[model samples]
Target: MLSQPPVWFILIAFIAALGPLVFFHELGHYVVARVFGVGAESFSIGFGREVAGWTDKRGTRWKVGWLPLGGYVKFVGDLNPVSMPGEEKEDLSVEQRRRAFHCRPVWQRFLIVLAGPAANFLLAILIFATFYVAYGRPETPAVIGPVIANSAADHAGLKAGDRIISINGSATRYFQDIQAVTSLRPNYSVDLVYERGSQLRRVPVRLGSEQRLDEFGQKYVVGLLGVRPPQLVYKRLSVFEAVPAACGATANVTKMMVEIIGQIVTGERSPKELGGPLRMAQVAGQRASLGWSDFVYLIALFSINLGFINLLPVPMLDGGHLALYTVEAVQRRPVSLRAQEWAFRSGLAFLLALLIFTTLNDLGSFGLWESVGRLIG
Candidate 1:
């Protein structure tokens, strides 16, 4: 039986994983702010009241807060939590006004805002590359492990121990390739070429349906072929092969992210798929139990997600700041305060609603709702 993780362990793992990511993200903004000659008042890792802190030679107060959810960098002459507020122009004294974020040139502001997301992407790439080199590449030969009786693959005459050669005449080197192709283009009959007893044979299989959970409480049906592919094993590679392997891993992860986004857009995935700190902790704990390398991979993936999210053009995010800067560059003036306020308000509301939905989703995922239903039933 698989061992279940303790809640405390999950919480600890969440903090450990999120802390450095948050720090690096905020530090990216701070570094670019300094480069742009923007005076930063304080840099905080986490939110709410400060716990432990120290002042740097640059007069930036670096502090850790009680809440480990997220962090921020406070630039001089910023009125609101977001340094991009409209009244930041009028809120400070003449001397302080000179140090205001809005006072900076548009290009400088753009770079400052762009740095955070850029840093996250860079971190993800580095972490992924490092892990790849350290653990060797994982590879799965295109071999069949199992075929469920009377299922698609079995009906198509696919047998255990058969080596898959191609799908629709396209050569497949790895089992993952076949799985990927099947996952994306489900419900269609696939022409599979396989090797059995030294003979190559072609088989046509119709994908069958399986129940899957999405963002809404509704269960959806997905097509499955009832074929289990061989597992990926760690295969040590030469230095040259390691580099390509790392690049391939990164590319694969990027493709997965794009697919996930597309699925959400198509309503094939739920908006409630979004997760907060609670979900992060659960995943972190599960990965931690898997082993150090698995945990590191999870961190790299999460870091990439952080990078991708920060680049979204939503108000109060790094990308949102960049969007505003782009408009100011073109218009030669900032958007009016009323417009900024309304945008921020709407963004905040949207974020809150998303948070509530995701939190509910997380609870449901943990079987909380199901357990409650069982008790009542």
Candidate 2:
């Protein structure tokens, strides 16, 4: 049985994790718009009716909303909070026209839209760099340790002290890289290149897998090669050196996310693994209990996820807006209002369905259905 955190703790942790990310994301757009001389009417931390607000010196209303899951910026000359151009914009005075988002150059509008996701990626890099500078990098060689009897690694003629040089032609710099590559493709065959002394060999290995239960009673099926990594050696890096390493780490994470999404789309992985607010809250609380460093890492991870999600070319999202801008740039005209409306409607429907499904997954992960069944019996 898994011990669950108190509901209050989950709520607090979730808020602490999400609030800053949301603020920074929206702030990115707001700042860039200001740079282009576009005025914002309102800047909100969350959606829905405002809970509390005050007008800034620049006349933008800054507010906290009832819903904390997401946020937005309402630019001047926008019909509503979605940043759709107002029909009345054409009738605006010269000063109002100058400050209207839609009236800005297409390049400026594109940059403003792009800034939000860019900020999120930047945030993750900063967090990772800070951690690397503080604790030094864990350098673990990709050498095979003791092999489990009858395991895939043992049957494949892998020996102790053999160094994994690459997987399917991609170089493996660390033991972690080997684990990452193998863990995603259970029951699949991969070409493994390893070095024994001065001799290099390539062998095809069918990965093995085992079902494991976590503390929350959720099951995961991960590929197993039955080889362990040697003890980690810490290498301290200068701040300058850590910056590029941090950027590489962030890029790798983004790449892995793209690959996982592709797998899910192609039916190679289960969509049920998708999580929603409940799972996030649970994980946030658990990480917070571990330590501040753990919690900070969680925040960075979520920030990346949020940024990537927004970059999907779906209407009503930043990517969708970018798509529209691209079309506008090519055609030298904005997309028709009717087309924009339909696209936004479709996007809204898709997002809503995704939210509902992921929420259900969260409930299933928490064993809520099982608990209900037991009570009924």
Candidate 3:
């Protein structure tokens, strides 16, 4: 059984994990805006009161905030750090208007907003590629060691020593490929091709699933094939090979995220599986405790997740700004201030509600909610 992590350890790990990622993400925005000659009023990591800060020669106030939950780049001509538009030419001199983010062309603004998420994706690729160069990519042949009795593989006539070649038409060159295809697809039927005794055979099987709790008691479902793996293998790749492979790995992670989110939105998966800061802290601590390598890998994974989430078409996000810019591009006019305000309010409220729900879920994972209720009674 996994034991609960210490609170202080979790807190430290969470901060260590989030701080750099946040900096890199916001740095993306700041750099792109600078390239387009748009000035930033403030660049901040975290929220609320300033812990430490300084002003740069360019007149940008850089700071670390107290909350440490999220960060933002407040551009000139923005109402607040969220980047809503401020007063136009009437209140500003010619130079100020030129450097104002709102005064920039729609196309430039779109790319500037997009750069944040783009940086995240690029960071993930670089990290993965670095690992591939430093350490050989680990993989093993798709050969089954032992089939679980009365399990999906067993029911489908799969046995030990069988080599999987493909699943539903996609080649499975390695054991990792097999895992990538099946792990997110709980209870799904697929055509699996494997070589057995010099003969190729196909079998159809519905995957099995089980609910398990992590070290911190966060629950999740994962599809199972019920087959033991063979001996490990690691293949060193050249720089050229590593970069493309890294791209493929990033794409695979993004695809899995999309599929899982689709299931959750469609009610196929429990919303309770959704997690917020506390769940993140637990996982971060687990990774930190394991080793620096594992913790760094977690940072890469979370970077991709952060990129994907910010790209969602919700109001008050980078994607939301992009969406509005898209509309402005097509319609040749910006959205009305009243409409934008209404949308922002709705988005803010929805995000707050989600935060509350996920926090409650986190507390329940630790049995804190029940304990509080019992105490109240």
Candidate 4:
């Protein structure tokens, strides 16, 4: 048997990551629809068979589903999970038709459609803000802890304990900021502002190309400056301090995601970096073993990711609906139903293929596929 992580960790992480995240995502649609007087028939977490359920005062069925990967909300007069289903046009009671989604004003409908992704983003900000407010901010010292021998810093005479204050004349408040700048390119030169003894000094470092293996065992060449940041120390924050701190965290995460995506698009990063359910299960198992704090952090990060992914402008996603709404606002007409149908079908197929590919990657990364191959061999 492979050395797999515990089952309980896997279960908890999966539930925490997908359960509330998906629920809130769908709930965004539900709440906004209700606000616009659209009657939501059901707000469900997951797919397939229904498990536990309750009826709300508004007569909405809130239920848990068997499949735990995602969820959806069904609204009155909506033919599909999304609001774009094509059904036979039927005459409705005035009361019933009045509460239908299509009867709302364009702006109102747009807001309802936009709310799902907005909720996800809001959740991420809130989680990050809460963490920052509760524990203040944990940061590594800007002083260099170690310099790799023969690395870029070594050649530039950069030594351990040197405190970095800026890069290329730009002030850096965090060690991560320095590391990000260093990863630009091979043979690139960056001016470092640092404190040596009692004197502030500036030095130029030429980054060198080095091959590094990621967690997936895929090797890629990246520029390295070879200075390490010291361990994190918790800093206290005042009531006024938490908001900006949280905003900073959100901005940092957004920047990192943008960089990673840019690297991927430019072929500087590998496609194998994409992961799916298996990767999540593996991470959950590992984080669970670390402790509750680590697990919670992982959950928060994944929740942010969940929010980000839904905002991509793909048909069948919340962003796609927003895009359509924006176009409608500009042109003063809805897009053709035929166009939407084809687009949604294409998007669904693409997403399914992506899921399959990511699942395979995850299994390979976890050594599950390798072990199976060995057994067959």
User: Model 4 Cα displacement at 268 (Å)?
Assistant: 0.9
Candidate 4 TM-score versus the reference: 0.84
As a whole number from 0 to 100, the lDDT of residue 152 in candidate 4 is 86
The number of clashing residue pairs in each candidate reads 0, 0, 0, 0
Residue 284 local lDDT, model 1: 89
Tell me the tens digit of each residue's lDDT in model 3 across 233-332: 8887888999998898899899889988898999978888788888888889988987899999999999999999899888888888889899999999
Q: lDDT: which is higher, 1 or 2?
A: 2
lDDT of all predictions, in order shown? 0.77, 0.90, 0.88, 0.77
Q: Assess candidate 1 and give its TM-score to the true structure.
A: 0.79
Give the per-residue lDDT of model 1 (tens digit) for 55-111.
Answer: 999788999999998888888876666775535566667866676677888888888
lDDT of 2 by residue, 1-377 (tens): 65767899889999999999999999999999999999999999988888999998999999999999888999989998778878566598898898999888888999999999999998999999998899987678999888899988999999999999998676788888888888888787889999999999999998999898766566799988889876776777789989998898888788879978988999999998889998999999988877799899999999999999999999999999999999999999888999999999999999999999999999988888899999999
Question: Sorted on lDDT, highest at the top, how do the candidates line up?
Answer: 2, 3, 1, 4
Please identify model 4 stretches exceeding 4 Å from their true place.
Answer: 1-3, 86-90, 140-146, 159-171, 179-224, 229-232, 368-377
Give the winner by TM-score: 2 or 4. 2
What is the Cα-based lDDT of residue 257 in candidate 2?
A: 92
Q: Is candidate 3 or candidate 4 better by lDDT?
A: 3
Find the candidate with the highest TM-score and give its number. Answer: 2
TM-score (all chains, Cα) for each model: 0.79, 0.95, 0.92, 0.84
